[model samples]
Target chain A: MVKLKGAISGLGKMGLSHAAIVGAHPEVDIVSVCDTSTLVLDAFKRFTKVKTYTDYQKMIDNESLDFVVIATPTRIHYEMVRYALEKGIHTFCEKPFSLTIREGEDLVTLANQKKLVNQVGYHNHFIGTFRDLKRLLDTDVLGDLVHFTGEAYGPVVIKEKSGTWRSDPKEGGGCLFDYASHVINLIQEIIGRPTKANGSQLKRIYSKEVDDAVYSILTLESGLSGVLSVNWSDETYRKMSTSLTILGKKGKIICNASEMKIYLKEANSKENLGKGWTIKYITDFAIPVNFYLRGEEYSAQIANFVDCIIRKSQTEINSFKQALITDKVIELLIADSKN
Target chain B: MKMDKVLFGDNQFFAVNHLSDEKSREQAIRFKDDAAIIRVLDQAREIGISTFMCTTHDRIANVCDYVRANPEKYRGFKIYPCMPYAHKYANAVTDLGIIGTIKQYIPGNIFSTFTKGGVAFIRKDFIGFMELFIDAEMKMFKGINTPVIFIQNVLVDLILGLKMFDVFKEYDSYIRKKYNAEPGYITMNLPALLDSLNSIGIENPIICSSINKIGFRMSGGINIYEKYLTEKTFRPIALQVLAAGALRPKEAIEYIGKFPKIESVLFGASSKSHIQETKELIEQYL
Candidate 1:
């Protein structure tokens, strides 16, 4: 059992989280790290023996790596991931894969051509309740999905404040990317890709540039319709909250990160679901992992990346193709908001 | 150590619900003003629960100001200020950029340390910067009785994952020497954190974690936690004991009450009846 060598390119919040997750893997050794923050890199240099670099190319060119987790800003994900793919290293880019659809598609094509084990960091796909929902949707628990309402809200940008990358639309800031990408990706995978979005609204409550909230009505490829509602300016929530509610002729299902609630008109014998309502905890469906962090889903996503790289195979869960669809949906929603 | 049998927490005032979002909003609406928060704190104090374990939110700063102003009225009240409110730094970093965040959050004395800093600062900046932030977070709780200072689970679990066991030692020494308070750790993974702290030779560590019947957010599961509770010597505090309102109060209290080694049980509620009932239950069961 040979170990794989890994490197991480960013040292932002998500980057540091991935470093902790990737650094703890039993089958991997973190050989190098790259970030613009001297303070963060200094901490890493002082704490661990991983080689630190200010330049992304210097880290990639200097180290012999098996994979790289690119957790940089959304504006630079294209260049960072493309360089990693071209270097023949497995790449795991963070969520909202790229700033634009063209950049996402180009990276997708390049990763495919290079035959790399590419994945994106949409950790929601690895959540226990969501995984169960995907499986249950394939079953008859919800007969012929009629509609859905996807929502995410957090107190991210409440007060009128100066701008960061989050408030800058060109830098991939906004509710659509920072907050709602998770919901859009979940809607794409669990339900169907939103083919058309209309009457969309990107409201700016605080920020000068990017939207603080996003809302729209969506029609899926299968012609199933739904509504998307997300807000980051709501000060009521303690943290980011994302949930999904789907309706069918037979019953309905509502789910979030912690638990799931389902209602049925009649019992489904094969799935062991009874009539009326059933409440299921995430622990029942959560898959155990070697390492634990903020949540099981985070470590599970990183472990999936390492496993896919070890097997030299691409992952369907949080894969680059799946993320490209999310990028596409973001563009559609933004275009609709203008109308 | 004058540990209270039943402690009142401030999670509800800050809209921190472990499971449900709707409940958090309800609490936010209920505790909308500083007067509302002080009202609950005063209620809990009158109900004989004196200690308030809360985060260093801006609103908590206002609460601290009120309590400091009216000392004789609210006599013998204590607060356990949790350092490094992650959201404070997160929102500051977003608005002010990295360097501005440092200048804004770190006390003026930190720059003096930086000016005197040499290669030693480079080597020890990670832990040293943490102390600086600790100093900043402590500004709001001045002239208040804080018996225990806690590091939130976000940093504790991050350290556990990084396997940076040495950071705990630095924090332990700093909190004890500078603040004259016992250092406490709050984590989701109690077993792993206990292992890390024990390996660092911090004996009889105080840990706050989820101990529930349904194992909601209990990282290593209920069995491992039970093994530690009955077998281990560390001081334990149970939170989310009701499993985010999932378990019946009697069943939850009775299950935890079976473990006599649990030193304290922390709960947050808005109503006086709920607090009185819970405090009674703790006395009755434990």
Candidate 2:
């Protein structure tokens, strides 16, 4: 099989991480890199032998790239993804597929029309524990899902940090867009689209422009309810930690980055050990991978994108259409918060 | 008449669920009997809460019935009725069409009601339509003392977002003139609503909004809400003080107690112990 050639835009933390993953993957070739800073460009110079460009459009026009990884800030995602899709390149944009729903819908339509493999960087979906939980859900082990509660807390913006675009509302700042997007994507993937959403967002300790904390109550189309509470400024959490508890008629499943516990009233399947509760750690289910930032999820997500391109198929996980639902949900929640 | 600093909320009694579907279902089943609701209210009264800030839900009509039946027991009981109980209108629209809904709620002589309804539709007089809806909502609490009539946050924020200040003026005037009640506004964004009411010359108006330590539902963030709580002229009633169960009882009441101008702390509890505990905590903290 031939390798897919790709280039990465933006040299931020996630951008550099994606570039490294792409450089290491056997089925992918890194053709070029794009960033405005010469310093960021210089850091990647010794590691990978590839041409670098400051302007994203120039790189898209100059390189014969098969696909481009858009890891830029949220404000520029619409324009970058549009240009990439219009150029008929399979695109992998970062989370928050677009700032606005209209832009996100247009990009999804363009990608589908062009028949390109489109994916978003919602890496949490590819995590082993979540993947296992999704598998468990498919088997109906937990019975009919009734309610879900998720919390994503971290110490990202505890103080008034100036310099970064993450603190600016126009740049798609706030835990709602940055952190809670992951929770939204995960919940939507696990439970399905909610019919109604009532939410609140607050800028507790961070800049006044963006929210450091967000809470939402979502009612699903299937009559199930879900709650999301995310605080990016909470000092109690060491790093970014996300936990989801899914309650069903027969049982419940609690999952986080480290472990997953399933409690059942009566075991139906033969594989079940008993009827009570079973706990599994990340070490039990996680597949060993070559690269790690948060986990193998990052590499797994990128690999899925490459496999879709190779197989000429649409991405099943974190597709542009799927991520569009998350974007729409965020918009609704923001509107509800203001009310 | 003065209201209680710790006001009992009717959300739990009406099964207005915010967090869990199962909890909501349980509450709906438990409170299916209005006697149970009255029992909780009686507990609240016994715990020394004189005011109940409640929505005009269909079940609340029964609560009013219970309150009015025993006037001797509930002699000092007052209700701050939050109006337009959006679900009622939504359920009405689902059951009856737009015109049928208006006909059902418009209170007056049939000829005047029809004339007013026609004029409202013809001239697109939203304020006139708003006044009719307010009157319809206030129908249940007619004989009871409703010292403070609130424009629900749903309509308040909708009007604020649409920049319909004239409707706010009309509601304020109608509630005061018709019921002799002080008009209050409930909103998610308190600071913004205060500014909107101030622009309309509604000075020191009563506003009920979400105010908590974690800033759970506070729209413009906690610090700005704190500033408004300190310096704003309005009588702010702090609701969602527990941040929807994020804060402990003591921490929740203590957080609100620190806010100088918060005229009241509104909370909901289904059990007697919870009600008594919450009242005791508020008294201990504040």
Candidate 3:
């Protein structure tokens, strides 16, 4: 198969990171970059040693690119994805597929009609431990799962000093849009979409007109409950962390990302196991596993996209249908918060 | 003349709840000397309603010290301290040792010196620099002539808990429906804060307001006090409570005219000029 060429738009931190990684990959080439800010573009250009442009359309017009990674603010997602897909280039975009489900649906339809590869950035779920846990659930290794819970928290933002895009609701702003997608995507990938979605979104405590925090719950189609909690106002000022605890008929699994601890207990067991488990008096045993990913999901995603292009296979790496469901879940959560 | 008791409270809008703040108690204690509080408290007295005092573990001393300094102004009115710590620390089911603390500090009492470092008997046990307020209130109301009003500090803690706003809303609705006709003083929670109050035996109680963090400026420096007030359902309740305890005398009269339910308002003061302005607002409203 021929190697693919990739370009990154919005040479911000995420853009620069993606560019550096793409430049280093053997099967992919970081051919070009784009951003409205010349200073950002120039800095990213020097760091990645790649050509840069101020406009994305111009980059698409000039470069012979295999794919464009849309790392711009969420508001630009629809336009950027559409422009790239229109040119028959596979596109990789950030989460919050777009601000609304309608836009997400449009992107999905376009990706399907043109037979192009579309991947949304939900790499956190690509962690080796999560992959192992998904496998365990698939094989009923944990018994009938009853509940899936996620808790994520971080320091509150009192000022716009961190960045300006977050404070503006129009730029895919607010905690729900900015952060909750990771939780939503993880849960959807594990238990499937919720039969019902309802929960709260906190816009502010002292600050006005912007969401500073959010807490939500989603009930899945399998009668298993999923709770997604996120707070930006924790006074302790900790970094972002999300942990998932899955309760099964015989045991429970606790996976805390921030602490890097995973504890498993089979019901009515005398022994507590960490990595491997063997029990006699219990109906089931819980096992804990962990590993690292060198952008395997992103690389696998791109490789899968390329394969779909060459062999005309169906594209299914966190596909548009799944992302659209995530969009709808976000919409419902925001609505719950407002009421 | 009939006396009316009106309670006004702010929706604690800070991202961090009061309990979550490492300095919440200390911060509240330091603000005890803030001249604005005395002015507001004095203004409430001038309006002819009983002066109501709010309690925080960190700031209870400030209110206690002010009342001690001005015995004459606060003669007939009693200081109703909402004992928050007891409820916070002691659980009958989980910790039986805390019951003694509750037995000592009751809500109603006039403290000669409300100091954070004072001592009181929690049942037979003597502990702390601050009084255990729950025990004191039970004593104050044993057979008192004036009816004793017990406002649950739970809702206040809930506000300080800084959970989801919807939790506040759910509790607000439940409290109002259950306690609307029940007698005695209860702090008015949000339109939704009443639920938790009802769950704990108090129903549909009146809520109070204290405008603290709501006065902050927004992105363009717009004073969002009005917007915050409207969004939290305080406007209608303010109309109901304008005439009661601890408010400017003239403001009380005008507020009473606007809403007949208001008989008194609770005011906090910090300086002579602030007190004088409150008096003027009251006089003008009158």
Candidate 4:
């Protein structure tokens, strides 16, 4: 099989994870890796013999790459994504497509005009439970979605930190942009785009630059109203924990990383699952991948991207256009948090 | 003319007891009559609080009638109506259904009101419905000097959450052009509302919200609120400064008075002594 050669920018945690996944995948080659830190580039060089560059633009110019994975800070996403798209390279960017709605819209327009395969790294979409939930929703088993509640809590930034860019409002939008982005994407995936939203973003423990907790109420285009609560300062959770409960007229789907429970008033689907409630563990349906860091989602998402490019088909991945919706919602929620 | 530095709130008169159910019930029973409501307003006026920041409760229409009737007694009395008094419409909806509720509360030109309602419904012109609703809410405060009108927190936060910037713009323009009053917003989240107002070209708006020391009912907490109060440009009218009676009168007044941009402190008092004591505290601390 002809492998798609790709480069990755910003060797942070997500960057390294994506690099490992892409390198392990049979149909992809890590052509180059770019980061501002020489130490990061040196570490990547040791792991794989791919060329490394401190300058992302230099790497884009030098390497004839098929696509570039961006896992940079929120502020720099606009410039990097624009540069790669302008160069006609299919791009995969991390969450929070851009800081502003205008920038996100511009990127989406450009990518569509160029007919490039663009995707945002909302990896939760690729998770086994979420995918199953989406399938159930698609099957109309749950009937019309009435509401959904998404909660994401973790111990990422419990205390005031000075060094990291994640703490900076300009670079990263703290917990609201970082953590809540996942919840928003999942909500959008289950229910259609939110027509309206109201919520609060609180800076409970972090510095004034970014918020540590967020609570929002969103109304989807289908009149499905939902709530999202995310707090990164909660130390009770051992790691980043996320759960979503989707309530519909007929039934409800409650899903987390570990398991998904479906409670139905009446059976509606062909899947031999019993009537009142059915529970499925992640291990029961999770697709085993070659590389795993958090979950198989990283590998699954990368594979989907590659499959779309190789097949020359319309990408099933969440495009820049789709991700822009989430950004717009975030902007509104952040505005709601002010005062 | 500038509004009073201390605006008397009508929450006490409306029986909005946040702390206890029994107090709420007792207050509700005590202020069941318009005479009782006017007695408190009279007490507030005696304390030199000329401005009454109040909801457009059904009883307030009677209060407006009383003030308009006794012009000499209420000389220079002003009301900043915080609308749409949600309970009125909620009760109306419960009793009269949707269209009947509209007919019951909608003021003036019944034919034109129904015409607009029909067209707005067919076209889904939410802005039209919102303007009509605002006009209807403002009917109770007619012929009164309302220099500033506030969108209640329920509606304000709903609009903010919906990203309905055009609705805010329309409200700003309608309140300015029709009523000749500055459109103010009361929200649980003050900083967010200010940002939304700024986004829609409203600079330094009059905003009343919960601003307290211990973050009681303050949506985004007190730290960011303090930053906005000190650094941002806006006329902040502090409410819930006592944090639902959490802080002592002295401590609450002093903490709020320390904020440089606070133009007014809005408090509710049903008694003459409480009103007098609150005025004295503001004078001493603020």
Candidate 5:
């Protein structure tokens, strides 16, 4: 296997997670860490056994790394992803990719022109249960889709106060841009491009500048309708999770990714997939089987990424350009916000 | 005014503001099969809906067109042409050409004969009684043997609510005496009128429109029925009506199943879908 020399930027929660895994993976080497904080840099250095620096530019200039993980805030995503791609480096950036559609489009164009391996951190698409769902949808398990709904919300820790650049709009701090990307990407995976789009946002009850809550309604090209609800300044809750409920002509699929649960309403059962939750016919019992995420999703996502890189495969994976359409969804909400 | 004997209900009345787009118009049309005019009549027939009245003469041509196009479909449904004579159409009657003969009997001098020199003298007689001019014209219409349902639009309710009982009493009396007949019902929206109906025991039923519709039955009169039992002002009165058992459960259901007292429900339906949905809703809910 061709091993990749990888470096991680912004040594925060997401950056640290990728560093830990990349450092340990057989086909990967965590060679350098980048961040503005000396304290975070020291922690990442000790943990990953890699050189660390306060300046991302210096790290890119000096390190012998093949690719970098752009886990920095959304505002800085364009610059970081652009610089990395310009230097012929592969990248995996945390969503939403960029603060605006123009920035995202520019980076996407740059990456495509360079023919670099770039991925978006919409790991929900990579989750095993969701992948199984995608498989079922492809196999006509649900038949023709009628409607889809995705809901996710959690407590907002002032991302700026958390010592990250997310609080800055330039970096994609707000809930509409940051959290709703996952919903938008998942929707694209289920249904094709929407023909019409409208959305609304509510102002933060806590913070003044950014939106804390948002709702979007989209009508796909196939006449399939969808709704997405998101919010961040939720003191009553903590931890972020997503649930995708798809209703089709024949059957339905309900996936609660945070809970790692997948429920299917199908006509029949598949034996090798493992024992399901509960099974009954259409009227008698709605859902037939439920699958737990079982840590297989994360591993599966990473495996797909590595396999694509090695095989030079054309897959949706490592396509941040394709993933940036969701950023436009955020721009829509911000424009029509009643609050 | 001389109206053509047919009318069509084509003016698309979206439930909210307007038919904003093609989807809205499509969805509205999808609510029914064929068209709203035919669907409403058909659904009403299945459930025994009898008469339908349009509150404004502006809808008369449309109503006639709807009836003329589908004679068999609307055969059983009686069309009651209601005029809001007390308000806008008094001057319009002349423009529509029916006022020539009536104007002769009353004379234009009474309407246009205002003299700046004798203004104080006319103030006591006609200052606040412009409705009287229309009342005289309406009396002339009584000769046309067909039934005329007069709608007291919601603005009349505000006048009554402001305790201007004289206006309500005069309008009510004029429709009764000059027409040599009691109006099938006065479509005012004040519940107190229902109380007035109950007190004076006027046999003419007061049909209430939707809350925003501005016609009157007693605020609590609709509460006497099951549907109004949940509304804020009407709920308590609804409970009292239930306790009093003014209407048997079976009877109340039958009453709501039919159109409100003044003929039929004249709402704006834009598409065939709205017609179908309205038909289905009336079948299921009404």
Candidate 6:
């Protein structure tokens, strides 16, 4: 079996998790890791034989890696991704791809030109419940889409604190990038991309710099309009929760990470769904993965990336081009907020 | 894992109802006070449940303190403390650096382990990290009777998927030697975990997993679980037997009762009637 030489930059929470996941991949060997934090790098240096470097450029230049997972903050994403694409390495970058839409657009073009496998970490698309929802939508169960709403809430910023990268707006730390981007991306993929966003308000309850909450009404490319509401200072939720509710002429569908509830006017024999209400939990339909982590979606996304690399294919459930679409939506939301 | 025939759980007290978000919110509101938790535990105790399999959440610190403060009233009561409550560690590592967090938890021997720095550190202190993490997770249950300590499913499944099966042996032996207690594992994937633990020579281990009629959260499907219950030699504790309220208590317990190999049933309920009803159903069935 051939092994892909992999290197990871940024050793934050997501970075460390990716390191562990790819390190455990049978078809990959983590040859090197780069992180500015010695506290984090010390573990790799002491525990494993994997070389550690402080400089991302040094790690890439020294290793001659087959692939790199870029988990660094948003400020440096463009340069790192461009360099990796220039080196012709398949890249797996984290979500909220870049701080600017132009940077995201440039990367999309670069990745496409380089003909490298590129996937952003939008793990929600890989979730069984959401994927099942997408499948059901494709069947036209929800007839003509009437209206929809995408929501996400969490307790990320319950207090006024700073100094971490999350507190820095330049680092893409806020409810907008950290939370709403997920909901927007999920909404864009599962439904359609929002063409225009207005009536937007970026509220700050705890954080001083970035908005702690985002509220907006969006019009999709299909002319279907919906609301995007997200807040990270919500203490009621233990962790991040994202939900989507779509209403149509025939039925209605409501989905979250754990379950999906579908309501129909009558029974659909073909779909095995009964009349009125059909509820399905995530466990009932989730596919098994060889490696499991926080959720199967995390591993599935990575596995998809690795499989894409092995196949020498570029199209993905979440390619850089698709993510840039979401980045455009985010930029419009922020632009509409300022007005 | 020797425990009561019916083990009371702490999920309700901690607002961890797995299925219904509304129910968890109600539970969070209902059990907001520590007294509410003590009241519910007393209700379970009145029903003669001597064991409480609970995650070592921050609130459990108060529960353990109460259990420790009351010696005579809670005689023969044991807690199955699940370790490294992921939320606490996730919050703590941000508040305190890695070494600071470890030192805050295990104040005694952290520096000694850190002092050994290099290949020798890798050879010995890596195990020391596991042992110390266990020690840190176990610090809350001091002086309380804990016959079995469980590693939370998150870490267990992570290690299992990583094929680091030796962590099981290290955790098993550490729990046995350091705490004089057996180590239990809680996982969503029972079959694969059983194979992994078996390969690591941890035979006939006690595992807690969901074993409902419809196989909610039962990884590898229900057929393999049935095979394990009928043929495999291990102590199986049935949890989420109600399928997160998808099935009736009577039907759930009866379905679980068919497996004579299931050693115990663990459940959580906020009300006295619900608790008593589950206990009776388990007795009538398992």
The prediction achieving the highest lDDT against the true structure is 1
**C-alpha RMSD in Å of predicted model 3 compared with the true structure:** 26.0
Instruction: Write down the lDDT that model 3 would get.
Output: 0.51
lDDT of 1: 0.85
Tell me the deviation in Å of residue B104 in model 5. 91
Residue ranges of candidate 3 with Cα displaced over 4 Å: A44-49, A156-163, A205-207, A235-237, A257-315, B1-286
Q: Candidate 2 — which pairs collide?
A: none
What would you estimate as the lDDT of candidate 5?
Answer: 0.51
| TM-score between model 4 and native | 0.53
How do the residues B135-217 of candidate 2 rate in per-residue lDDT, one tens digit apiece? 77788998999999998876676556434576688888988898999999888768877887899899999888888887655
Instruction: Provide the lowest-lDDT 10-residue window in model 2 chain B.
Output: B90-99
Using DockQ as the yardstick, the better of models 4 and 6 is 6
What docking grade does candidate 4 earn? incorrect
Separate DockQ for every predicted complex: 0.35, 0.01, 0.01, 0.01, 0.00, 0.27
Q: What tens-digit string does per-residue lDDT give for candidate 3 at B113-217? A: 433322232212222212234334333222212222334434343232222233333333432343221223232223223334444454434544322221110
Q: What is the per-residue lDDT of model 2 for residues A35-146, given as tens digits with 9 covering 90 to 100?
A: 8756556434532367889989999999988999998889999999999999999999999888998899899899999999999999888777888888888888877888
- Between candidates 3 and 4, the one scoring higher on TM-score is 4
* CAPRI docking class of candidate 2: incorrect
- What is candidate 2's CA lDDT for residue B44? 86
Local distance difference test scores for all models: 0.85, 0.78, 0.51, 0.77, 0.51, 0.84
lDDT of 6 by residue, B181-269 (tens): 88899987788889889987998898998899987777666888899889998889998899887898998999999999898998999
How many residue pairs collide in each prediction? 0, 0, 80, 7, 37, 0
Q: What ranges in model 6 sit over 4 Å off?
A: A49-51, A62-64, A265-275, B91-136, B160-173, B189-205, B211-236, B242-262, B273-286
Cα lDDT tens digits for candidate 1, B141-199? 98999989999888887777666788899999999999999999998888888988998
| C-alpha lDDT (0 to 100) for residue B200 of candidate 6 | 76
